[model samples]
Target chain A: MPSIDVCYSPELLHLYELEGKAVVAVDILRATSTMVTAFAHGATDIIPVMQLEECRAYAEQGCLTAAERNGIKAEGFDLGNSPFAYMNGQVKDRTVAITTTNGTRAIRMSEAAQEIIVGAFLNLEAVAQHLRELQLDVLVVCAGWKGKFNLEDTLYAGALAERLQGEFEFENDATLASLYLYHAAKDDMVTFLRQSSHVRRLENLEIHKDIEFCLQHDTYNVLPVWKRDRLVNLKEFESLGV
Target chain B: MPSIDVCYSPELLHLYELEGKAVVAVDILRATSTMVTAFAHGATDIIPVMQLEECRAYAEQGCLTAAERNGIKAEGFDLGNSPFAYMNGQVKDRTVAITTTNGTRAIRMSEAAQEIIVGAFLNLEAVAQHLRELQLDVLVVCAGWKGKFNLEDTLYAGALAERLQGEFEFENDATLASLYLYHAAKDDMVTFLRQSSHVRRLENLEIHKDIEFCLQHDTYNVLPVWKRDRLVNLKEFESLGV
Candidate 1:
């Protein structure tokens, strides 16, 4: 079996040998959740851009652009970091360009992997099953806050690591720490994360609904795979334009 | 109230503003436990050196030298990475220059901190109480395996952070995750860590007793504080000749 490891933050991305592994890019707080929500809600595609200007270019091209900095939505964008923005039929058949403080940076940094798939609690089974099918060694990359470690991302990675534990050889200490956490907090995520730094930071911003929604499990049967410069639902992306 | 934070590894030592903060350096699997045991067994002082040659210099001067590389005791050194080596009244009243794979490197890397204190499960309560006395912002630095994250170190940090939770504000996600882990595993640490990578790695190398001994709670009341280039028991280091 291939080995499964975790990169606690994007800053430690260099420590892992990710050349041929599959990278499960995670930002459970919002970015990956929003991306998974967008695809599941029938959004045509999502372009994860690292720079605000790139997202702005997409906005200028008439696509729905979302940018977030320091937990606040970017100015003049159609949507903030809210998952609800992509949840309803609003983004049906549309394209969304998202640039977030941490998630996009993680995606851009983990480009060396064989595949980069978006993951969040919203689509846990989807992402886990996708990785199971690929059967490649997995590296759960937590898009921590500005090169620092955060709880939500690591928890999400832990959930996935727990899901894939038997199939993959757990080779890193990060993997063990996270799997233990997943077992400890699996029963009550929202309550478990109540004391976490990101949740509290967002609470002050008054986004209780977003945080709650992100912690919900298996609401989407979609795995957003980054391919050819955009994130597409793995299931739908495979059949499109054939 | 001092803010409490955790650096998951010494690799992230640069992220913390350590100039005025008190650092609780942790390498729970072996190094700090060995030092605490050395102190509890009446070793006068232990010098932590990063480079093997520096440790060798102390060895040449007739001080006992202990070294470990890649989990095995280093070649021609007095002791490997075991707490038991310091027990049995072997190092009583002697000075030791000790270097290990992770712990000593973390001590040297975090020299910027106002103070560095050795922490392991063996002296968990002692270290926690010492930090409460200082009331300075605390950064629990995990001496991870070569710039990567590890389980035992993070769990020890979490244990201390949980012990001092109310006196300090939790400042980061790493801090929160670790505290939660400590709370969850408080009753049964040995079973919790049985599945971890380092334990398994060391098990194959036939050091199960070392792991079990390291995980014991507050077995040694001695607190090893780094002052003026060496680690000494905080209680007795003050009484030594100037």
Candidate 2:
């Protein structure tokens, strides 16, 4: 039986050896939720780049570009940090090259793992099933806001932990702490997050609807995998029995 | 209106500036709990040192000494990491120099704060009362196991947050998470900690009773304050109405 641990933020990423462990990257406030939405639509591939120049390089090759910083859209990018942007026809059958303030940085930092899967409340069931199938030690890496721990990512990590409780061994205090939070707040997530620092910060920007939509559970079944610098739906490889 | 925050480990001490804040350091598994016991028995002072040599220097000057590492007593130290050692007559009216793997190190690392007070569930009310009187932003710094977060320290931090919830504003997610944990484990602490990684590791060494003693609430009312390179009971200053 593989074990499960949650690295509370990207700053703690160096403490774990990720050579053979499957890593699930979570940024529930928007980034992973947005990427999962992109895959749920008909987008073929989404390349997550660490720098604006790297995202710009893919944009030069005709990929739609999106970038976010400080909760606002990057001045020159086509899409900001909103998941609703992907629901429109702009991403259907197209590719998106994107960078975000937190999530893409965590994805790039996590490329050393055996596999990197984007996870969110949107695809909770699918991601839990995928982990059960792999049966390898899973490390949930939270892309905290600027190397600091945030509530939403930790809450999402706990929700996955609650779903996979008996199937895997919990590794640290953080794992149990997260499980406790998930159970305490499972009843009404919106109310649970009402006073969180990140939610209030986002609400200040008038994106209340985005926060509500992003918090919905199992709204999509797509699990985006980081492979060779791009994210694709993990189901594409399921037929191969991987 | 002093705000309160909980740092689950020393690794987060850098995230906040400590210049004008009052810090309450906690190492509930043994160090802070033991210190509270030392004060409860009328010990005059405890000087927390980082290195064995620093403790040795204090011992050479006629102060009693205690040191712990890897769940065992240092080879030649006068006492190990048990809180009961202080409840006995060994610490009464004597100054003791001590070193531990986690707690003492956190004390040394937090010297920059305007004030440093050691806290544990044993002296829960005294510490909370003292913080209410200080009227400065309080940072509950958990001396986690070697720069990583631990269960007992976080639980103690949460218990403090629970006691001080409405009187102060919470600084971050870690605070709310700790409060959640304290509430979850409030009913039966020993059973709540049975499966935790550190508790299990400590149990392997057959020091189960120490865990139980450390979790007891209101066992004492001594608040140990760090002053002039030594920790003296805060009650020593109560005569001045502080």
Candidate 3:
């Protein structure tokens, strides 16, 4: 069986040996959620940039720019971190260059992996099924807030670990730990994660609904794969060399 | 009210503005566990070093060295990471330099904080009480395995968040999410975390019992604080400007 290692934060990515593994990057709080939602709603691809200017520069390629900070949309950007904005129908067939406080950084950091797939609660099922089918060693990269572990990412990792358990062997303790947390809290995942520091911070912003919505599992089955400096549907890779 | 931020991994430490917060470094796996047990058994002080060689260097200070890897006692070390080892009267009145994979790294990373308290299930109450006595903002830093997020650390963060709900304001949604997780898992925290990646990794090494022991709450009231490249007993910090 293929083995999987779970990296709970972006900083831990370097500690992980991902030379040949398929890296499943997760940012459940909003980035991955937004990406999956965007794809599911018909966006063509997302060019993930670590810097705000890089995202702005993508505009030269006719790409839409989405930026966010502290839960609010960044001014002068075409989109925000909110998933609803990605679903506004203006995203269909459009290419988006995106930058956020945490998720994009994680995606950029995992570039060395043999393959990288965007994972979120919305697209979890797709990610799991894809991993099981590929039968490659997997690494679940959680884009914690600014390189720190946050609940949404770990829970997503736990959920994936739980789903992928029978088909894969967990290579590290983090993989098993996350699966255990999810198994124990799956029944009331949203309630269980409500007190997490990141969620509490968002609550202060009155975005509790986003927290509740992001926790929903397997809501969409879109698989966004990193390719050509962007995350597009896996089909984009199949056309190249996935 | 003081605010509590549960950082699931040390990597997320940068996201927090530590300018004036009292950071609680939680490593439930064994570092905090051993520290608390060491103090409970009357150890004069516990020094936490991120590197094994640092532990050896501290040994030059006329202290014992307790090093652990893969949950096993390392060769040439006076002690392993087991809480029982520290509580078995081997650590009383002795100065020890301890090294472990996760907790020690967490302490080192938290050196940037205004204050850093070593926390675990065993010392949750003491940590909470200690934090309550101090009016500064608080950040719960989870020393996850190798810079990754682990369920054990986040659960401890959640547990502490639940305990301090009335006394602190949550700085973010992550805190609220962790508190929710703690509440959901409170009935059987040990069992809830049994499947965590960290515990499972340890279980493969036949140390599931350690996981159970690490989750026991209020087993001791010893608070460990970071100082001069080590996490020593809080009392040791009376002269360090704490």
**Interface RMSD, per-candidate values to 1 decimal:** 1.7, 1.7, 4.4
Q: Mind giving the per-residue lDDT tens digits that candidate 1 earns over B119-231?
A: 98888888888988998999889988888987788888888887887899886778877877777777888777787778788888899899988998878788888888898
Identify the CAPRI category of the predicted complex in candidate 3.
acceptable
Single out the weakest 10-residue window by summed lDDT for candidate 3 chain A.
A233-242
What are the per-residue Cα lDDT tens digits for candidate 3 across A1-242? 89888887777677888878899988888988888888877789898887788778888889999998877888889998888776657888899888998988888898888899999887777899999888889998888776665767877888888888778887565776566567767888776676566776777888777777777777776889988677879733211100
lDDT of 2 by residue, A117-178 (tens): 99999888899999999998999999987777778898888999888988999968888888
Candidate 3 local lDDT, B105-181, one digit each (tens): 77777777888898888878878888999988998888877666566777788888888888888746566556656
Give a tens-digit lDDT track for model 2, residues B121-147.
988989999888888999989987767
Q: Could you estimate the TM-score for every candidate?
A: 0.92, 0.94, 0.78
State iRMS for model 3.
4.4
TM-score of model 1 (first chain only): 0.94
Local distance difference test, each candidate: 0.84, 0.85, 0.78
Ranking of models by lDDT: 2, 1, 3
Residue B19's lDDT in candidate 3: 73
What TM-score does the predicted chain A of each candidate obtain versus native chain A?
A: 0.94, 0.95, 0.94
User: Candidate 3, after superposition: displacement of residue B46 in Å?
Assistant: 3.1
**How many clashing pairs per prediction, in order?**
0, 0, 45
Docking class of 2: medium
